[model samples]
Target: MRILFSSLVHTGHFFPLLPLAAALRDNGHELLFATGSDNHDTITSLGMTPIEAGIGLDVGAPTAAEQLGVDPDPKAERSPEELVRLIVTAFADVLPRRFVADLEPVLAERAPDLVVWEAGNLGAMIAAKRAGIPSIAHGFGRVGDDDFDVQGAEVIQRTAAEFGVELPGGRGFGDRYLDIYPESLQGKRFLAEEADLRIPLRPVPFSKPGPLPAVAEGERTRPLVYLTMGTAFGSAEVLRTAVAGLSELDVDVLVSAGPSVDAGELTGLGDRVTVESWVPQDQLLPRVDLVVHHGGAGTTLGSLGAGVPQLFLPQGADQFIHAGVVTEAGGGEQLLGEAFGADAVAETARRLLDEPGYRQVAGRIAGEIAEMPSPAEVATRVVKPG
Candidate 1:
């Protein structure tokens, strides 16, 4: 069977899905990995056919600040509302057009058996329904949350309606806010009224207990803490602050600055700190004792999969919500507020390293994650639905 796996440009969103795409290919199914133009090389390298889809909106964000020229490291600032507006404006109506324009050509040529869409791809789902193909929604973070599902459903309905696809009635809360979306999404109803367009969301396919990286033979043996603020927000100040805080303690620090921030820009770091732009969190998480992250979904989930305690410094958006979830699950701590100094970072690292409860909690979460199915198995189930 042929399958189309759609996602956004963010590596965090794309990487988690790649393992599944590879799994499908290995199982004798043809897979087309569709995403932003920026992700073309990465997708092809994973041994799947690549389709250049539309550019993605900044979902992981302080959306407004990012839009109106807010330098990532705002010397001093905080406004969640502006951030929300920036995110909504970028995606709502814009997402459908770009997604449809990019995908229509691909759907015309490939005509896949099924469509697998990331939660972020509102347009892909509509296109799939229009093409008379079955579509599956893959949940990446906190799939257990009911609120996210509700928001997702509303996004689907609003975006689809613009493309002439009718959504099942009965939406609540933020769903009503769809009216505030851009006017580009208004159009004729192309879908039949009775068509069952509701797609079931599948649990995240986290590969476990296999293909982990080996710890370096000469690796230093002090407590190891991995640090990241995510792809877009791992600012230079954050890196410097992390390095400074961790350096004071007796621990080995590995920091992945992500693509946006250059680790080289961080200066005056102690010898115990090592920085890189990218590290396979799936491989690195298990070997670490603690993780200090910006609370992105992929990092949080990857850390949980590895069973490592986290210190989440959520800057904005879903990070705040995810941080709360992590705390509720007893696997981590949410350090919020306008605090990003060496003293604050050091205290958090100390608590994470010296505390016994954090370790125990992480271990339990890791055990649960280990029980989840590999992405390949999940794809097999979806592709061959009974």
Candidate 2:
């Protein structure tokens, strides 16, 4: 069977799905990605073909708000409810609409038998439905308390109606759901919780392959902490503040600034810290004593898979939710609001290192993740050979 994988343009959304794609490829199925034009090389680098599709959320977000006639003054603050409504409108409506348009052509040209979409790429399934193909929704991490499936279903139904497209009327996205989260961290509600076809595939953390970014290049010394804001969030100030806190400890801090941030601009932090635009996270997590990062699903599950404790400085998206879950699960700690600072980070890192409970829980979660079906084992279930 031929499969077309879909995700939001960003690496955080795009990377998690790659392991599964690679797994399917290893099973002798052809696979490709439909995402932003900029991600073409990123996909091709991993030896997969890329077909550009849809705009980024940054472009689709404001447009969704504008369509809703909820334009806000730049100077004004947005209420929590309004912010969520806007997000729902974008992912469930505007972005999906655009994605359907872009994917219609690709679907016709590619004629893929299966469409596997990450949680963020809601429209790909709709496109697949329109093309009379099967589709599956794949999750990246622990789902929050939000009822995205039920609420988003309403918006998706309306979007489908606008296009005069009739869906199979299962869940909002698709009937089949690929659940990558470890069963322990699944929290209260799971994505596609009610779907009969929901299946668990272990969260395999993936990043661009690279050498370890440690500049000192030594066998073993003091503890090493891998620091990052992930691909979508964080700033120079955050990096510097985190590094300052990590500095207080007798640990080495290596920061993966992500592609958006220039490592050269982050000079003068002295020799205690090493900054790289990116690092091989799959390789780095186990080497680190602890992880300090924005709670991205890739990094969160990656750390858990490595049995490494973490200090989450959540910036946005599911980071806050992830922080709460990890803290509750005893696998890590979260820093937010007034509590986020150099002192707080230093103090938290101390607790994470000095305390063994965090590592123990992380190890348990790692064991759970390891026991879950591997991507290769699950790939055959996603799309069977014709």
Candidate 3:
């Protein structure tokens, strides 16, 4: 079967879909990833074929910002409701029109058997329906409390009219919904009524395989903590602050500053602290006793998979919701706004290290993750539908 996997241009949006793509490919199914041209190299690096099929909206552009009505302040805090409204109204609703235009030609050429898309890529869903192919919605992390259908109704209606297809019902498009996080971390609303269509799969973390710094080589007498701001929000200031905070602890620290932030820009680090431009979380999480990071879906699920406690300093978007879920599950802590300072980070790190309950809950979640269906198993089900 020929399957088309679609996502937005960002790595965070695309990375979560790789494990299933690998599974399908390993089973001899043909696959092509469709996204913006910006992500072509990232897809190719993972040994998957990428077809460019979306517009790269410049969020920094005055026109774009005006269209979205978003505040330019990067540090401004938004409640989950406000964030979801902004995402749906400004970004999500507008992107699908361009995605539909970009994807139409690809759909005509490939004639795929199915379309597997990230949850937010509504254009893919529209294209799949138009092409008369089944589609599946793959989630990056825990589905939040927001009602996506209600939030995205206007966009859905407009896209449907443009594509000459009927709008999806209240449940939205997709024959199946693939949720990567364990049931415990999922929003209670999603689990309560929509569990029938939601399939649970273990969140397998993947990155562009590359040579990493030799942090795992020697024996360590103290606990190891890995700090990162992820790919999108990484800044030199965040790295310096993390280093300063964690340096006060007894544990050894490794900070990944991402590609945008230069490691040399960070200074005043003690002998126990190591800073790198990029370190794959999948590779480093095993050796980490605790993780301090922006509450990205990848990091949240990856830390749980590794059985490591986490400290989430969420910036915006679904990150705040993810942090809340992690805290509720007893696998981590969420520090927001003023609480997300150097002193608070260090104090939380100390408490998490001194406490064993966090690790125990993380272990339980890890065990649950291990028992969920593997990508290979899900792939078989995808091919031979029940």
Candidate 4:
């Protein structure tokens, strides 16, 4: 079978699909990745054929934004509710049309047997539907409450109209849904009441291939804490605070300042703290005792996969909800906007490290993740009907 995988340009959106794509490829299925031009190299680097489709906000002109008649100002302050609305309007509604437009030619040319898409990329589902092929909705994290109805409704309606297809009630995108999160971490609201529609796959942690850091080589004398604010939100101030707080403890700290943060800002912390612009979380998580991060779905699931307790300093988006799930599952703790600081972070790190219950719960969740179908198993199953 020829499987075509699609995602948005963002790393967080694109990375989750790789493990399953790899699984299918290893089984001798031909694979092609359809994403923005910016991600072509990343897709090619993973040994998959790349079909450049859609627009990258960072690389291309603001054609999508112009089409939507909205100016996106990253530094501008907006309420969380407003931000969510903006995201829904732009990425969910407007961008899917662009994705469909770009993907139509590929669907005609490639004629793939299956179209596996990241949950948010509604265009792939539309394109596949129009081409009369089955598609799978692969989630990045815990499924959002009402995500199918809320985020996908408009895109489905608009795209179905263009293809002259009738969408049955409650159908949004994809013939089947693939959720990677373990049952314990999947929030109550997002749990699928219908078992057959959703398939559970083990969340395998992956990152850009790289050599492990030297610090990860030796046996650790002290607990190791990994700190990151993710790619988009990392700042020098946050890095400094995290470094200061974690350095005060007996633990060794590995801080990924992200692309936005300057590594020089984290200098002079101490010998215990090693600061780098970035290090693959997959390379570091297994060796770390705990993770401190903005509760992005990828980071949250990655830490959980590694069985490492997390200290969540949630910034926004799904981070807040992921933080709640983490705390409720007894695997970690959360500090919201105002409460998040160096001192509070230090306190939570101490509790997570010293408290045996957190590790125990995290280990349990890890076991649950381990019990889910592996990517290879899922790849074989998905080729058949749901």
Candidate 5:
């Protein structure tokens, strides 16, 4: 079967779809990815055909943040709840207009057997429906958010009207759903219940091709701590705060501030601290003793997959929800808003290291993830060549 995949063309959104896409390719399915032209090189690097479709937020223009009068300083000022409203509105209301224009032509020509789209894309949903093709919804994080329904419906109403498309439910999640978020860490929104066919797939960790650095073999001299703020929310203020806290500890620290922030700004913090733009988290997660990071979905599940304890410093979006759920589950701790500082990061990371309960819970979560359906299994379930 020839399958077409779509995402927001951003790192966090695109990475989640890769494992499943790779699985289908390995199963002898022809694959095409519809994203921004900006990611054409990246898609080619991953050994897949690229079909340019969606556009990410243009900092040069007025975005949903500006429309909502919210300052988008890596979400330093607003709460995650406020940020989520902006996020949902942008993808569902604002950006879909452009996506429909770019993707309609591609849909007509490619005419793939099926479409699998990231949760943020309502345009892909609309395009697939217009083309009379089956599409499945793939989630990047926890089940759902309270803001998801309210924002998705309100904006989708206007969007449906403008496009003259009849959206049966005014919701983005499709008839079939790929549930990547583990039940242990799942939120109250419960996306599984919303879908007619819910397939629970394991959240396999993935990092772009990179050579893993050699860590000392047998007995460790000191615990290794990995720090990252994700590709989108790489704030120097938060990174410096985290590095300062990690440096205070006896453990050696490795930090990746993503492409948004320059490594130079993060350098010269401490002799024990090392900064880079990227690291192989798939290989590094198992070796690290603790993780200090923004509570992005990929890292949270990646660390849990490796059974590593964590300290969550959520900057914005769905991060705050991830932090709260993991903390409540006792697998890790979180620092938010006024509570986010060097001292607090130090304190929470210390608990993740010194405490046994956190590691114990993490191990249990890892076992559960291990038993869930793998990408290969779901690939077979989704399609079988007749």
Candidate 6:
């Protein structure tokens, strides 16, 4: 099958989808990935065919920050409803017009067998519908909201609706994000069995299995701390805070700041801290003692799958809810009440390290994550739909 993949144009979002794309290609399917031009390099780097779409915000654009409504100051909190309103207006209102306008020609030209859309991309699914092709909503994280009525296709449909484009089906008529557009079937069968989608719980991105880094083997001698704030939210201050928290501990700290944060700003980092642009969390999780993160769905669940103790310091988005899920599941602790600082972070890190309940709960969550289908497995089923 020829697949058209559309998603949010950020490295973190695209990175997870790479494994699935590779799997489809290996299985003899043709894949074309579409996102903002900003992510072109990342798309090509992953060895996927790239379709350029002018539908993303510039990561370095000052206006982009204003558009996102993220206050750089950690102390200032946007009311949850206000934040929701901001995000809803941004993606559901502002983004669709631009996205749909750009996607029309691409849809007409590609005419793919199926559109594999990131649940957060807004209007590509609508374009797929416009092209009269079967489309699948692929979520890289938890699916929230019931609008547009299709399961998990929040970004796509909402963006389309904003542009006054009617979808082929009614609302509540397709798969939810987690289910990958199950509601849209109307009895149409899928290549991957629906039952298989349910078996592993959720899709996880991973590279082909390989040996761990040489340093990783010996690094396990002490408690291993995997510290990251995800690809989007990393900052010098956050890195400094993470480094400070782990400074006094006997643990080996691994920090991934993505390409966003400055390396020079991490000057005072402790000797045990290893900072990098990226690391293989799936590969490193088993050897780590605890995972401290900004509560992005990808990292939160990634850590959970490893069954490692988690300390979530959510800064935005659905992270708050994901943190709540982890806390409710008894998997780890939620660091609340303040923007993180070295002292507070250190204390939280200590709790995650020393608390027996935290470890036990994390172990259970890991078991749950492990049971989810790998991303490749999910894609195999989705592509080969019966």
Best by TM-score: 2
Candidate 6's C-alpha runs over 4 A off are 45-47, 59-79, 145-164, 167-202, 206-215, 384-386
Deviation in angstroms for 196 in model 3?
2.5
Question: Each prediction's TM-score against the native?
Answer: 0.80, 0.93, 0.92, 0.92, 0.92, 0.80
The residue-by-residue lDDT of candidate 3 on 1-386, one tens digit each, is 99899998776788899999999988888889998887788778766788988754344222334566766454556666655565665444567777778888899988888889887777888888888788888888776646544667666777677678787543335357888979977777777666678888778999877766676556878888998888787778777877788888998888888866788887668889888887777887888899998898999888998999999988755688778988988888988887767888889989888899999999999999999999988988877562
lDDT of 6: 0.64
Please give the lDDT score for candidate 2: 0.82
- For model 5, how does the per-residue alpha-carbon lDDT over 248-285 read when each residue is reduced to its tens digit? 78988888878889988886887677788888788789
* Clash totals in order: 1, 0, 0, 0, 0, 21
lDDT of 1 at 299: 80
lDDT of 1 by residue, 1-386 (tens): 99998887776567666766777889888889888778787667667888888675553233434655664443345465544444554444466567877898899899998887775666777777777777765545543234444444565567678778786543211111111111111111211221243222222423223432233224756888888888867778877876787788988788778887976786557677777667766667768888898888778777776678888888765777667767766778766776767888888889878888887887776665555565655655667552
> How good is model 3 by TM-score?
0.92
Q: What is the C-alpha lDDT of each candidate?
A: 0.65, 0.82, 0.79, 0.79, 0.80, 0.64
Ranking by lDDT: 2, 5, 4, 3, 1, 6
Off by over 4 Å in 2: 70-76, 147-150, 166-174, 215-218
Instruction: Itemize residue pairs with steric clashes in candidate 1.
Output: 164-190
- Report the CA-based lDDT of candidate 4 relative to the real structure: 0.79
Model 6 clash count equals 21
Give one digit per residue, the lDDT tens place, for model 4 in 167-222. Answer: 55333343677888788777554465535577888888878777666776788798
List runs of model 3 lying over 4 Å from the truth.
56-64, 68-84, 147-149, 170-174
Cα deviation in Å at residue 225, candidate 2?
0.9
Q: Candidate 4 at residue 191, lDDT?
A: 65
Cα deviation in Å at residue 191, candidate 4? 3.0
Looking at candidate 1, what is the lDDT of residue 119?
56
